[model samples]
Target: MDDAQPITTLSGQIVQMGHLDGSLIERMRHEALTAPAPWKAEYGEFQSGGWWTTSLMNASGDAADVRIADGSARPTTLLQHMPATAGLLACLGLNYMWVRLARLEANAFLWEHRDYDELEQAERHRLHIPLQTNTSAFLVTGGTKVHMDGGRIWRLTPTYAHGVCNLLGPDRIHLIADVYTDDAYARLTKHAQEPTVDERLPTASEADLSEHLATARRLADLGYTAAAEQLLLRLFYSFAMPEGTAYDLIAGLHTALGDAEASKRWTAAKSTLLALAS
Candidate 1:
């Protein structure tokens, strides 16, 4: 098996997945929207409210084990309920490791962050099939914004810091599949095209950083610690900072607030969160 390469080394963060059946996608979206299964909220530390997920295929068939890794991909009851979706996956013939439905409600935001950092080093990739989405729901990566339209599969290299948001929406849902690198994937992506840069984020000036830092301080002084932390975290999406800069800013925020313990904790978290160990 090949060792997993750092996400930063990937050639491109977004790739096109070719065309898919629109009617089938509609059915999958309808099933997901109507399903009664509980939608698990994302970790409080990572995102704001309104983001939810439910596993379709995962290691051990457990919905709670959302981690990315090499494991026996087993379908959950949720997959059984969406026979059309199962058929679609079967037709693709990709070696799925984890598959899930991700829902982001209106005004939801997934703070800028990286994924697969905690997983064992292996060749894998995350693929997204937009089911029900709107213009407002888009992904920001490499300082560019991309609205993954339906009717095609989109690939996201999550090892790089990226953020997603549904700024205004009824609700956005996507069928996400984590697949191991294999011949099928290689062939499927043989014609993969680079994503067009929809919008480029401007570089943050020193003055801009200073203003943000000062605002964070005010928010912290007002007793909105979470808000303060998030205000700093959003900077990651706006500017190309060195890895772990956001966490460092949060740590500094705590230190200035005289919370030495919190400062130490966030500093430690920066290391643990960004560590890429095999």
Candidate 2:
């Protein structure tokens, strides 16, 4: 019930509550990989290019509408074919808002950021079921890295600043559901436990940061602007810095390169991505 309503912007906790059947997980994975899903490239500002999502349940009842919104959600066309997933969802019996299959491709990232800020204020939480994932795919939050292994339901209070990466992945796909709090939610999360792979992220010293900044500047000078920006963004995974340091570094990179406009843009990106107060 700690998830009843979060008081802080960043929950900073990854709790493992309950689990799923292994055979059922494999079945769902099969459907997720083989089924013809209308994957949409959404939340462009929050992710690298390869991150994609398809709705299993949404207000519009369409698989292509991946954005979270308020409504009495229903299953999308894509969910119809996924009986195993659908069955699991039904059994959970929580008050639904939306559900989706998020696919993070190799070398992809969901940069350090908060969530649910764009939605109507409500008591809700996100549950993740990792169907297909690799060792290199993990989530970073509270200055720590957590790998939400399969065969379990993982709850992450995404209101906190966090980042996800599929560094060397084949593909990391997960079933993410957003549901309103209710009796069913209490039942599902009653036995919450700490994540198994919560490892504190390593810190980057000033020298390390300077070397990275130099590398980014070099990339930018070579006209690899996008790559340079990505390099800075990826710093979130490599080191433990304050919430928006990567964005700050990016702005500095542009400023050092004499691109005032790009610097200003990255400055704004920092505020937006971190949901920072103006």
Where is model 2 more than 4 Å wrong at Cα?
1-12
lDDT per model vs. reference:
0.79, 0.87
Clashes of each: 0, 1
For residues 1-278, write the lDDT of model 1, one tens digit per residue: 11322123225888776889889999988888886656887565567788888888987776655545678698887777788889999988999989988999998888766788767788999999999999988887766778888999999998877778888897989999999999999988988887653666666666777798899999999999989988888786667555666777888889989999999987776655554342
**Top TM-score hit:** 2
Stretches off by above 4 angstroms in model 1 are: 1-10, 276-278
Q: Give the TM-score comparing model 1 with the true structure, all chains together.
A: 0.88
lDDT of 2 by residue, 1-278 (tens): 01122122224478998878899999999999988899999989999889999999988999999888888899999999999999999998988999999999999999988988878989999999999998899998877788888999999988888999998988999999999999999999988988765677677667887898899888888889899889888988877776688888888887888889988998888778777777
lDDT of 2 at 271: 76
Candidate 1: minimum summed lDDT over ten consecutive residues — where?
1-10
For each candidate in turn, the TM-score is: 0.88, 0.94
